[model samples]
Target: MGSVLVIGSFNVDHVWTSDRLPRPGETLSGRYSSGPGGKGFNQAVAARRAGAATRFVCALGGDGGGDLARALAADDGIDLRELRSEAPTGTAGIYLDEAGGNSIVIGAGANADLSAAFVTAQAGAFAEAAVVLTQLESPAAAVLEGLRRARAAGAVALLNPAPANAAVAADLLAATDILTPNETEFTGLLARSTGTRVADDAIAATPDDRLHDWCRALLPHGIVVITLGGAGCFVSHADDARRGEEAACYRLPAAPARVVDTTGAGDAFNGALAAGLTQAPAAPFAQHVRLATHYAALSTERAGAAAAMPSAAQLRERFGELFSAG
Candidate 1:
């Protein structure tokens, strides 16, 4: 299979599970655990377990967290290209409620140290990639450089603008081929890029045509995927580039899943989507989206972030025979 290259961060995550989220200045007792996470690492693990040949590129500190990252990558058979950093490893504190919702705070240490020069040095790896998936957790210059190289290599350049607060420039997004944003991130992008404000909660209820217009405005030359969590997902493609789909815009219902934790659902979607693209390049775009939604749903059935990603076999087992075709 062709490779999926993921360029981003690696954060060791500390988690707390409670019956409900804590209010301001509120402290509640909850179960505690720590593990390997970070959007980039979570997605990389997801892709690898989804049966793709994957590579993860990031910066790591000379610490136990970094060692954990390296060990995990090796265990998963992911080709890891990590730069050593003087800064400490990144970390995240995640608070998960009983309802499967979560709030996260990140300490971007070595993650912030990933440089454009490091990304540029991965030209050979980029050349072998079929899909290059990246997020905004790392430095913008490094992320932008990865996207630019992906375009130059003729690989599918997929961008996930997460955190809903990252400062993304127009030129950085100009190089993207597929832009995936959850509802909140979509709202933020729309407001920042087009000066249009559509409340995130109202996105699913908005007219399909209107959402398509907003998506076009966000990425005029590319495709836009707005993941609406339990409400399902929406897809909008540029008229000129439908990527083998019959419709320019459409929606897919959420796949069934028993809820546990949702910390890595978005990462699962992006990673599985990348895997599907490489594994089934000739399939209709909708088919890939189906695989991603199902994969993501299955991920929610488990707990933790990177540890929560389900494998291809598990996905097929949960969703039935449909996934066998993937």
Candidate 2:
């Protein structure tokens, strides 16, 4: 397996489960728990579980959360050599209703302190990696710096623009190999609608007559992989005949499973996609997307973000049957 490096935030998530989301100023009683989370940490866990040799480069505060972050990374066998302790670690407060929907608020504490210099200093690790994944949890400047170094090191750059921030540099995105986003994030990027429809059972809007225009808007940069939670994902590749011929599009239906939490589904999918690409670079893009979907489906079966992430053995045990049967 190729080495994968994850650069982003390490947040301790405080989760509360309630019967229903509270209305404004409404209070409700619910279950409560805390766990390791953050897009970077979740993706790193997912990649490590998918059998990728993964490393995590992030910042935590010199507090209990930082200690827990290190412990969790150690337990997952992620290389924490690049992880730093400076400010207080970041934290997230999340509320999940009975329908499995969530509302999250992040206190970017030390995560906001992640700097370009820190990322540039860790460029050597990217040199040894086949893939470097980052998200918007950290500063945009830091993310761009990481991408610059990853590209210079000849590593494939994967960016997950989460939390919907407009401060992202377009040049950095142009250097990315794969750009993964959910419905809201994708719509945020395009800035204009192609009059696309949210496909039945699809969590994201699919390209219709407006998709071509949307692709035309983004094609000059990098490949776009829009993840449709439950419904699957749609991929547009640069060299795809569909992009040139008919608008290259690939969709992977979500694997059948009971969903307990949707929180980190996108992270799981991105991690699985990165790991799959590393393991099977020659596999068709559609196949890679399918593997990601399988890993994501498995993730939703359990609750919590990183806690619910499956290990390599468990993932293979549950889904290996499908692979073999096929």
Candidate 3:
């Protein structure tokens, strides 16, 4: 199998599940739970369980959170490369509604300490990777460095411009080979890239050609995959680089699934997509997206973040007829 290298953050997620999300200053009683999360770590675990040899690089503090990260990485068989930091490990507070919608607040402690130099130093990992995946959870400089090195090594550089508010520069956009963004994030990027504001709620209704135009403008030379929740996902590619796909842009419906918790669903998609790309380099790009969609839909059936990701065997067993072996 092929390998994937992930550069991002690891957080101890504190979650509260309630019948409905609270309004400002309105107190509500709910059930509390905690577990491993962080966009980077979630994707790393997803990629590994999706059947890729995965490597995760991040920064961690000398705390219980850090210990949890290390122990979980070991359990998942991910090659962990972390930098020690004096700051506390990162954390997130998440609130989940009965419908599985979530709102999160992050405390980016040691995650802010991931440096460009540290990312650049992992040349060996970058060199051996078939795909190098990263997100904005870490410092922008560090994320940019990882993407650059992935490009230099001829690995497919995948960027998930998540959390909606993370500042992504033109250089970072230019360096990415594949860009995955949910509706909110795509709107944020569109506003930043072309000064055009399409509300997140309107993304699913936007015309494919119009969406393709915005996607092309955002990353002129790369592929853009916009995940649109229950509406499924939209894929846009440069005319010259369709990755053997017949259409320059297309939409795929989400697989059938019973929803529970929506947290980490996007991470599941991204990780499974990376696994498919690495293990089946010659398959049509849509095939990878299909696997990602199925995997993501399956993830929502469970709770938590990293712990919610389903294994490749489980994916096939659940959607075997829909997702053939890569």
TM-score of each model, in listed order: 0.99, 0.90, 0.98
At residue 295, candidate 1 shows an lDDT of 96
Q: What is the per-residue lDDT of model 2 for residues 257-288, given as tens digits with 9 covering 90 to 100?
A: 78888889889988988887676665566766
Write the number of the candidate with greater lDDT, choosing between 1 and 3. Answer: 3
User: What is the clash tally of candidate 1?
Assistant: 0
lDDT of 1 by residue, 1-326 (tens): 57999999999999999999999999999999999999999999999999899999999999999999999999999999999999999999999999999999999999999999999999889999999999999999999999999999989999999877898899878989999999999999999999999788999999999999999999998899999999899999998879898899999999988999999899999999999998888888998999999999999998999999988898887787666545
C-alpha RMSD of each candidate structure in angstroms: 0.8, 3.3, 0.9
* Predicted structure 3: lDDT: 0.95
**How badly does each model clash, as a count of residue pairs?**
0, 6, 0
Give me the runs in candidate 1 sitting further than 4 Å from their true place: none
Sort every candidate by TM-score, greatest first: 1, 3, 2
Q: List the residue pairs that clash in candidate 2.
A: 61-87, 61-88, 61-89, 242-247, 242-248, 243-248
List candidate 3 segments past 4 Å from native: 321-325
Cα lDDT of all candidates, in order?
0.94, 0.78, 0.95
